[model samples]
Target chain A: MFDTVNLEDARRVIAAAEKKAAAIGQPMNIAVADAGGNLVAHVRMDGAWLGSIDISIKKAYTSRAFDIATKDLATHSQSGNQFFGIHASNNGKIMIFAGGIPLKRDGRVVGAIGVSGGSGEQDHAVAEAGAAAL
Target chain B: MFDTVNLEDARRVIAAAEKKAAAIGQPMNIAVADAGGNLVAHVRMDGAWLGSIDISIKKAYTSRAFDIATKDLATHSQSGNQFFGIHASNNGKIMIFAGGIPLKRDGRVVGAIGVSGGSGEQDHAVAEAGAAAL
Candidate 1:
């Protein structure tokens, strides 16, 4: 059976991420996905960048689909790296960036959280806050 | 300037749609979009079909893009119809079927909601519930 994040869990994670975003003064679009790489919940904070909405959701899917932090994926997907063309796959859903992280349960990846609408460091920080809540 | 649904409005709409989906005994994937056809929020219930995820988001985009229910658009998009090939437009984002409804404010289209993971009728019903909330 596949373990995954539920709606309630997604809400809690989002709440934490929102708090972190507020602290950093960067509005963000946050998204959560289940183990199946299906979106569970998403939120675009007031004043968040509209374009980041799609990126945030797709980042969540990419993290869950690959069960890896997108920051690491970005490193491996650079020009001379093994995953150079991976982003062209997945119908453009693969987001090799710093804002996607897997959510773990009992040391197994159960889902993922993605944050956007800020610099890479800020987005990654917000996602980490959300993932820690899970 | 485009008057559009905000993040708070999207959540209220999603909550109402979820309630209706639960009443109808069907899990659903729901998505809400702004007047600009950008996503504001999306949710997939615990047992919602995974494949419907993309459909739900695209349906919302289609409704907002055309400012019409996909149900009505479907009729006009039938074989040999004027809009028969419209679905092939928008880089394949158009969904000529039920479950999408435009959200109006002061007699103006502002945004839209889309639902999936059930029969077309059920999906339309849920989307109607969401639109009513807006």
Candidate 2:
């Protein structure tokens, strides 16, 4: 049976990402989604815009739903056939772009983490930190 | 000088609301917005549809921005001049209906709380629990 992602693991990932962001002096919003595309945890830093929360969750949802990193989806959407429409089809819940990465354990994807509020590159960096912590 | 609402206060309100919902066995999504209409905290219970998050936040935004309970706006929009358009003008960030109430301290509005993921009456009841906790 596939077990649900542990909430403590998700919090550790977020803490690691926050530490990295703090080191860079950037505030961000982070969201974690379980393998079932259900939200596990979310945090929005004190200066981060409220919109970042939605964007971060969308990115995480896209990563978990597609079972791939959001960065790769951004590249594919630009070249694939009517791929961008997939986001609209999902009731605008999926965001195909950087800043979201699937979490893996023993080569199996368990969940996804997304970070937003900074530039794409910065957001990607923060997401990577979260993934690395896992 | 006005006192800024502390995060602990918000958490207490949310806890009370959650306890009430637990007693009723209804899952919910709740959002709290600060004096500046910015999200201070948000919680999504398991089994609550993801869409509830957006609806809750929009209700809180509408309550805070309009300086009235969201339930009142629903009634006014049906009989008043171009009132429903106000929600559209706000970039779809406001929802006019029940389930939201502004937080008051010393007779001044300090913030707002919104609840969703159940019947309108249930949502309103949960929000009232949050407000009463304050």
Candidate 3:
């Protein structure tokens, strides 16, 4: 059976991330995706621009699809040949950068969460809060 | 506070519709959007062509953004002028067609779900199944 991430879990993750982000005085857009790499939840903070939503989703999608954190993907892409075309191949949704965390339970990836609209370090920190909540 | 649709609700809706479609031997692409018109979930059946994902998402986005079923938007589009350019305006993600249903709870629209990769009528039936589950 496919491992699933449920709503309550996603909400808790998002809430925790939001709290951490608020404490840091950062506004962000967050996105979550299940094991199948489909989106499960998302939020754009009040002051966030609309484009942040797309960036957040792309980061989450890349994390889930590649089964690695997006930061790792960025590193891999830098070492790449075939990976160069991935963004175009995935219809512009696979973003290889920092800001996404793979959600793991029992050493298996269950989903991923991404945060955008802040510096890469801040985004990673917020995403870590979400993953820790999960 | 935002009225959110969780992963459990989205999964149940998608599962119910997938079951119904499988019972009828139909291949489809399904999409779900949260209240804000951003994608919450999507699935493209094995036999479905890749393009169906885009179609399904566009339908769901249109439904959530307009707070009207996609079919109704199609009808409205036919009724005339100002509605014509919406597709272009939304970066080509709005499909005013007969394959999307708004998900409602307590008479308030909670989200929307869409199905494509089949005949419009078939897509509508699958979307209805998803809505019923919600």
User: Considering every candidate listed, which one attains the maximal DockQ?
Assistant: 1
Worst 10 residues of 1 chain B by lDDT: B38-47
Highest lDDT among the candidates is held by which one?
1
Q: Which of 1 and 3 is ahead in DockQ?
A: 1
Candidates 1 and 2 compared: the better one by lDDT is: 1
Interface RMSD (one decimal) of model 1: 0.9
lDDT of 3 by residue, A1-134 (tens): 87757555776788898888898998888877778777666666655555677888888888888888887777767645546656666778888888998999888898899889788889999999989999
Candidate 1 to truth, TM: 0.95
Clashing pairs in 1: none
Give the candidates in order of lDDT, highest first. 1, 2, 3
Highest-TM-score candidate: 1
- Root-mean-square deviation of every model: 1.4, 4.1, 7.0
B10-82 per-residue lDDT for model 1 (tens digits) = 9999999999999999999999998888888998898889889889999999999999999999999999888
Predicted structure 3, TM vs. truth:
0.61
- Worst 10-residue lDDT window, candidate 1 chain A: A1-10
Q: In angstroms, how far off is A133's CA in candidate 3?
A: 0.4
lDDT of residue B106 for candidate 3: 86
Query: lDDT by residue for model 3 over B1-134, one digit each (tens)?
Result: 76756655776888888887887798777877777776665665656645676788789888888888888788767546558667676777889778898999888888889888788888899999999998
- TM-score, per-candidate, Cα-based: 0.95, 0.75, 0.61
